[model samples]
Target: MWGIEAGSVAQDTASGQYAGLAPSIDSWFLSQSASTASVSKMTAAREAGAVPMVAWSPEGNLTEIKNGQKDAQIISMAKSLAAYGHPFYFRPFAEFNTNWETYSLGRSGNTPQALYGAWRRVFRIFRQYTGSKSLFVWTVGYSGSISPLKTAWPGSDYVNYVGIDAYDWCTSSSWCPGDQYRYKTMLGALRQFDGGRPAILAETATGLQTADKGKWLGAALRTAQADGIRALVWFDEIVPNSNQPDWRLASPSSAQASIQAALKQPNVASPKYRDITTLESYAVSASWAKAIR
Candidate 1:
């Protein structure tokens, strides 16, 4: 009754957790493998309307899944995966701006050019594979150290949705005078890239008690509505994982209630994710996104 990530999917299959969990994975992620047996299982799971989410470790050489590492490798693998007959979410190198261990920009001297090359090739391949809404997600760190858009921005044409990953980015340095600080910056950046496209908070954590999560979330909703951002993906740390600790850990019920309330507000738009097809038309021209200043 849950979406299985790569780490847990292995054991789940071995222990026959699939028997208990298969139904829950409906419309969510399920681990797929290079093996036909696993693929068949995944297919069966998906045929039931469950989304057998597959991870494309393109940046990781289709084996390692690095952050900003591969270009030709990603394109090549994308083709192979498409031929395989099962592609879900189509999500690849997610956290580029943030300094995550799995994948990051600063690694192997990842430059803007390298990122662009990889992005363009991936976009082209994905377009060729699925010509409609297939869902390709490009996620960013909510509190990116590299501002000045150019350093942080990637090809918008390849990205159907804009996702921001923010973890306790409310430190004195990261935050400004008050709520106005993060709100203005996030809204402005998202609006520029959005261009009428759907956007999501992607991953955010109000884990920290000091930060006024309620106020921050409320103001963000109001500002995004005014600016017209699409949706908000709350990063609640249900338990310890790769995303917790470093981000906001919501404690007070008020913080939880406030953020929940704001997101539920009907007037505000919901975050719209990208499918496999129609990425090109929805995405911003590489040239235009690079113009970020």
Candidate 2:
């Protein structure tokens, strides 16, 4: 299955353009604060025939969450998602290995033990309200401090999947100029840490370099299949980094043909409700509107 992290943009702007090339996308990845709007966005994804994979970042004091002070918000989110009544992926404080997140190790007195405890606390809260509807994903970034990746594991009981966010930032520096980083090369460490759980390419994109972006897309999908990566999500936005590559595929570019070809493979699953009629019936039901609200 293929998904997307649409960042801060409108859902249609991201999903619509990709759907134009691929028949469908299996999931829509969304990042959210502790906002009710997240629930609305999840509902919208279902209406568009795509499942939602939400990365919920509290973005506040990690000590508070670790100490159970934020149970109310976590409970509320779990309840809303449970009421939504469909299987969806939920990742809390994703990229715990990276200093960019407030919940990461070595940030504000946080350690691996603290991260583990905090994750278990959040996981327990979600279990109370969501039951099986919420699938917990433990996600990390590939290009960050490495030790936290091992220490932050919240045990197999709490996690249903392991995901890694990686990108091909080909540039003219000594690091990666025109580098065709194979999927396995970037994700090898994370994959080993997965411990037999399903792996997902939670977020990824390629920059324009000397390599053929189209061919690269095809190769990525092929490697993902060969490597037992169960899911993938493309990061479809152009947030600038030190390297000057526009990552957005919303417009026609050199990568379009390869993207289309890759997505059309028989192994790739398109986004469609498991049972659309049932979902529609539930939506019109009185309980549906009240639950989502």
Candidate 3:
């Protein structure tokens, strides 16, 4: 549940003030892709000149640790980026609706076009390095209303999939605290924009539980089944030394039951929704090309 995709490992020192990080942190961050430890490293970097100052970019800047680890996640990204090149899944600072991380929070003067351009730069770099159909995903945070859709969207060539980062909150309020992000509910909303490729829960908070976590879990599954979202990823923050609960969800043993139960029901597949039957469809373009499977 906890994974770290380290790129160019850097020493956490501005001249020996001991930036609160451990030597291992420096040892790991400073490792390069070429080093024996980084023999298999890969990094997701944010191409400079892409996003505009009008927008915000946080987690979006996946520092291409020149010495990125050559593991599953890192290698996968490297393979995709080096092969398909630019215009890949440029989902930078998605889910602006949620104030979780600096990457995705609020927007003031930036237009979607400018945001789109920034993202395109990433994909373009990937394309330049990879190939076509790099499969870039533009996802939003979840468990609440989607406000970014109201803004401008990137051009057709730049984006491939539209997704959201939904968590399991009892009711649709804020983060998925007590009530886990019921899979069913999240899937239900995903169905609204079904055009197919694959509607995804780009990021999800799980493992932690409140009183009604189980209920939320049950409802989430049902919702996903009814809606047809194709994929989901549980973002269990497991970075060493960072005890901040913001990105970290509960990993307590008590919540294992709920986590196990959710994992068991994996086939919450969708056929991609088409047609603007609902008002929500109109807002979120229900098209196959818009969906990145």
Candidate 4:
């Protein structure tokens, strides 16, 4: 299915455009630190007929989560989701293989074992409190090292979907602008570790480094479809940092035209989304929930 991480932009603008092209739209929620769950965001997405996907970052110590110091806070968030009574995609501590996140192995005093313990603790807590209403997604940054990626896995039992966050930023003098890569080339290696689980392009965007974003978008969609990727969620936002190029897709641009054309393809449009109820079945299944215990 097609979706977007609206970032700071209004969800209506991002979702409305996609809804015009596809039968269903997916909305993303990114929570930084230990903020309370935003039930209203989920409600707004559902009201607009979009499925909500949330990425929750603790932004604090990973050891606290593993040691149960954050149980109350985490459980409170899970309860709010359960009360909503609908299935939603839940990803915690995303990009853990990179140095940017607090829970990542590159952080001081953190290790692969520490990340695994923290993830399992959070996963088990949510599974206990929310039942099958939450679909756990394990996401890693596309730029992370392959060795760290293998070591940081929380195991297949705790994850429902394997996701990768990648972006195509043509070229910039500040960073390696010429280091751009195609969709399949960036994702091919990671997909091998998916363990037969469905995969998602959880977060992605292409910068205007190239004059024609449309061609870039078309190529990306074609690659994703050919690789059997289950979904792609565009990160539709402008990075506030001055050094970063705006990643938002603008109207009257070739990139926008390419998106419109690519989304019209049968393989990309009108997704047969899995019912949220399927989460409940997975939650209670021996194969899926065994590790949670």
Candidate maximizing lDDT: 4
* Number of residue pairs clashing in candidate 3, backbone atoms closer than 3 angstroms, sequence gap of 3 or more or interchain: 56
Which candidate number has the best TM-score?
4
Q: If scored against the real structure, what TM-score would every candidate get?
A: 0.54, 0.80, 0.49, 0.82
Ranking by TM-score: 4, 2, 1, 3
Model 3 gets an lDDT of 0.37
Q: Which runs of model 1 end up more than 4 angstroms from their true locations?
A: 1-57, 61-91, 101-103, 145-156, 169-183, 186-198, 208-216, 238-264, 268-293
Q: Rank the candidates by lDDT, best first.
A: 4, 2, 1, 3
Q: Once model 2 is optimally superposed onto the true structure by TM-score, how far is the C-alpha of residue 90 displaced, in angstroms?
A: 0.8
Cα error of candidate 3 at position 203, Å: 1.0
The 0-to-1 C-alpha lDDT of every candidate, in the order given, reads 0.43, 0.63, 0.37, 0.65
TM-score comparison, 3 vs 4, better candidate = 4
User: In candidate 3, which residue ranges exceed 4 Å CA deviation?
Assistant: 1-80, 83-90, 96-109, 143-150, 155-157, 169-197, 206-215, 238-250, 266-293
Model 1 accuracy (lDDT, Cα): 0.43
Candidate 4 backbone overlaps, count? 5
What does candidate 2 score on TM? 0.80
Q: In candidate 2, where is summed lDDT lowest over 10 consecutive residues?
A: 284-293
Tens-digit per-residue lDDT, 1-293, candidate 3: 01111213221121011111111111122212221122222221211101100012322322221113223333444454354222223344465445554333243433344455545555555455455534556666555444444343454555555566655422332454444334445345444543343555555544333423434544555554456553343344445685433222233434435544543443321111221122123123422233212
lDDT of 4 at 61: 77
Tens digits of lDDT, candidate 2, 1-293:
65666563355335545544321223443344654435666666666666567778654566777888777777777787777777677878777788877777788887888778888888887788777667787887777766666677788778887877778875333455433344455367765565677777777777654235555566777777677776667777666565446666543364566566655655554433224344334322201211110
Instruction: Put down candidate 4 lDDT per residue, 89-163, tens digits, no spaces.
Output: 888888887787777776767777778888888899889988776888888788876676656677888888877
lDDT of 1 by residue, 175-248 (tens): 44343324346545656654544554444434445436556656655655465444343433344555444332
| Off by more than 4 A, model 4 | 8-15, 18-25, 171-188, 191-193, 209-211, 251-254, 269-293
